[model samples]
Target chain A: MTPDALEGALRRPFAEPANDRVLDAAREAFEDVGIQRTTMRDIARRAGLGRATVYRRYPDRDAVVAAVLMREVRVFLTWLDERIDHIEDPAEQIAECFVAVVTGLRGHSLLNRLLTLEPAAALPALTVDAGAVLAVARGYLAAKLREHQQAGRLRSFDPEPAAEVFVRLAHSMLLSPPGCIPADDDAWSRAFARTHLVPVVTG
Target chain B: MTPDALEGALRRPFAEPANDRVLDAAREAFEDVGIQRTTMRDIARRAGLGRATVYRRYPDRDAVVAAVLMREVRVFLTWLDERIDHIEDPAEQIAECFVAVVTGLRGHSLLNRLLTLEPAAALPALTVDAGAVLAVARGYLAAKLREHQQAGRLRSFDPEPAAEVFVRLAHSMLLSPPGCIPADDDAWSRAFARTHLVPVVTG
Candidate 1:
């Protein structure tokens, strides 16, 4: 898909405005205060909606947080899909995808704030829902890896596990970045991917 | 070092009995309640020591908790050192280390309880001190990778970044394990290291 197509998809209005507003407000509040401290009333106030409206849309704070995270993942995948679909080489595609994700997440304001200001509250949401979240990412990568394998562009391996490692590595770097690697630099990501990621995925 | 030598080193008693007792008590108290809820009084009572003695040993709850965690890390590293010292193959050594860590952490009662019961409290300790903790792990791995590179057992690559990736991957898996890969299984860990880790270190 073209970048314009991806942007168009992202720009499409949510079917439920109240839900979208609640999620946006929750994301902002989560970044500002934290998940544990943020209340439904605060979210409602931020969204410019009544408590009843917020309640009707999201049963509780967890629901709103989950919605926000799901939305973030969807947006990230859309952005990634647009740029990587045309890359023919499996290693290059995977490398580019990793670089894009690291750079994209590094620049993301809410995510960066959440990790920095409120890690305790943020970590639980990520850890407990890790399986579900990783399933989405693994599915995306596994499908791509399988395609490459079938086309003789990648080596034989169980794409699911390989993709799982890739996704886990990305999540780890994104959340608790070990500054040992230059994650903010795209050249570093590509070189690191060539030595570390490509062999894992293709071998 | 031989197994017996390692055991002998571990058998050496702590320099200060009061410090050891207080730290042990703090760990238990943290596990029983939580970091936020556990008080100096609770720790003193758990240690079977008077309030004055506990105060003299540790000024506050945070100090006691930090001491406990530092001691725990030291013990874990010592134990790991004993097990991995004899393995000559860099790949095998690294794989065994990862497997040992995953398996050891899975069975750690206090850590598991803390993570499961009071993630909001436990997560802060991990995240706030992530730099210090990763530095220790990264330093150890980088040293090993460099030694291997010098010995011609590993290929030419920047060892620091490679070590960072290795350590980060382990930390991520330890905290929020992805079920897509069976990290707890020894055979699986070995296979994974051979395919993924060996290449990263030796490429």
Candidate 2:
């Protein structure tokens, strides 16, 4: 279908499918010129949309960037869910999650580029901002922990705090992996999860 | 004592007492104008020495900055040792260390200023760059862990890697504390250490 027709069909009251197209274009522009230099016009042009339409969808470049980052995070979390959905044991599930997250982030082209080129902008969200993405991550993990606790698969603890620790640990390693843990070593990552992480939520 | 007399009394073969003066001067300059803008001449002027004397002590501004950073780390380590030296329990020691470090960094004038004014230059040491300061921190912790393990107080783990995790966790929290954990809550910080950290080094 044509871009116009596709957007018209995909646009919802709260969100639109065109949002994805605009963000994808924004991601490309950001990669090419770096986030600091990429403009709304560039994204609009790349998305095959008028500046007015792009502005209607996203008010500014910062809004577009936030959408792009959130979209990326959602996509990654979806992949993560699928990867560890079948694991029965919480320990195994967390271990797999750690290994998968580290491995996935290591290969993530856009995130790696941003970390290398635009760390000043990107690092704050992972580190200091504690914004929507982190809240979503913590909520997701907490729900899982709660579910397992109800099912008698896990011990009783404050799942929110436990999930918070898990999320921060994952973020810390991804942003600035410890020197002692050699990168790309899945066995070591899993072992670390088992040794250091598994005990946090378990009895 | 006069500067010249002090230098004669304190100078060694490889490093001289003047090095301390130069580094102290550079630290002040870095704190005032930031590492990026602070020049060797500024440091020399602050040290009450000639440009040639400062240059002889440190080859360049970067060298002076490195020495200043190392000196600061040494001072912090000395303080940390004194604070946690009397804690007998391994878990208690680790927990207190985390609280003390977070508290210390929060109050540190130079570090707080650098983090705010020159994050681009100062952040790498805590995150990406594995510098001498980080190495010294990890080594100090590892030595304590090793001693504890030998005394049968903690688990038998690779002290270096364990120390690396401890150091990185502290750095992560200092650099980007989790939103889940409230800042400046000594109780929460200690609980986090007891829950997540003490396990790694203790059985």
Candidate 3:
């Protein structure tokens, strides 16, 4: 499926209160026992909703998982927007965004837990099946780059591919950070971004 | 383990003729039944060697898998070296290297089969447990960048981290491959490397 379609489907469940309850319950269950063991009925029981109600909103557990993951991405994007909104320099903004994403994802509880406990389940979502997450993040960065271009702070370039490259750098780093690169160090991440990532936009 | 140590171990099996036979058999078995189902005994039988001989070389199936992957990396690196041997400009060389790697990997039968049939097994080796592979590739690029620096073709920077970034970009692109970025297109990949990757070295 196209990333936009997948992202739209993921966002649809956010509009309903019942869906919110379902996601909250799914998150709790996932944290308690893990995603592999969290059944549809278990989610319904935890949410205090009927099985049919949960099914009406989400066709199966995978859909619920995708929705939960998308919500987390939304939360992350909002936090990222707030952090970088004040920065006017395109280079520094991009650098700080990279730092924030790497640090934020490193501290993310559910993602770390899933990686540790159930890599089989978590790896695919982050790697092969990461379309929705990648789409949302690339969109966020592309929009920011466009704004920077409009403000005459950045040159005219296809922001989409540049944004994808930036996002992928962060994605690869978080998944399997190389030994040469320091992890979770704010100063190091910032410097690396300035040297490596800023050029992608400014050049 | 350190990447150097892992790489050293991965290369050790190459000195033995029996090890080559074992790896060939293991590759065949992996291509036939997939890595998850390929066993030491199966490999030994296919190689016309005793189980003790196989066990003596590799303590387990995981070790065999690592050795096979490392061998493939070595072969690819050799091919890459030959392909870019005559290029004078560092930017064009890096661009061509990226194109070669992305295209070479996309057509790799064993790696492709594993990624398609047993992502659970393949993903970790490329992502979380990718230290050896990443180390080998990064080391190769760092050496090349260092050569450029020595020859005054490129400015001095920590070639190590820069190389890691290059390798990780290719790594992530091969694994997830965002929709915004065109795939398996030589012109696009080369242009991307020039626009996005060359800056990491030249800037």
Give the top-scoring candidate (TM-score): 3
Q: TM-score of each candidate? A: 0.84, 0.81, 0.91
Model 2 residue A168 CA deviation in Å: 2.6
**What ranking of all candidate models by TM-score puts the best one first?**
3, 1, 2
Global Cα lDDT for candidate 1:
0.74
- Report i-RMS for every model: 2.0, 3.0, 1.5
Which candidate should be chosen as best, given DockQ against the real structure?
A: 3
- Candidate closest to the true structure, highest lDDT: 3
lDDT of 3 by residue, A92-178 (tens): 888888788887878889987887787777787787778878878888788788888888988888888888887787778767755
Docking class of 3: medium
Candidate 1 residues lying further than 4 Å off, grouped into runs, are: A1-18, A31-37, A45-53, B1-19, B45-60
TM-score, candidate 1, first chain: 0.84
Ranking by DockQ: 3, 1, 2
Task: Please report, in order, the local distance difference test score of every candidate based on alpha carbons.
Answer: 0.74, 0.72, 0.82
- Superposed on the true interface residues, model 1 gives a C-alpha RMSD in angstroms of 2.0
What's the ranking of the predictions by lDDT, best on top? 3, 1, 2
What is model 2's native contact fraction?
A: 0.28
Model 3 misplaced stretches (Cα beyond 4 Å): A1-14, B1-13
Give me the runs in candidate 2 sitting further than 4 Å from their true place.
Answer: A1-15, A51-64, A118-126, A130-132, B1-16, B35-37, B49-70, B130-132
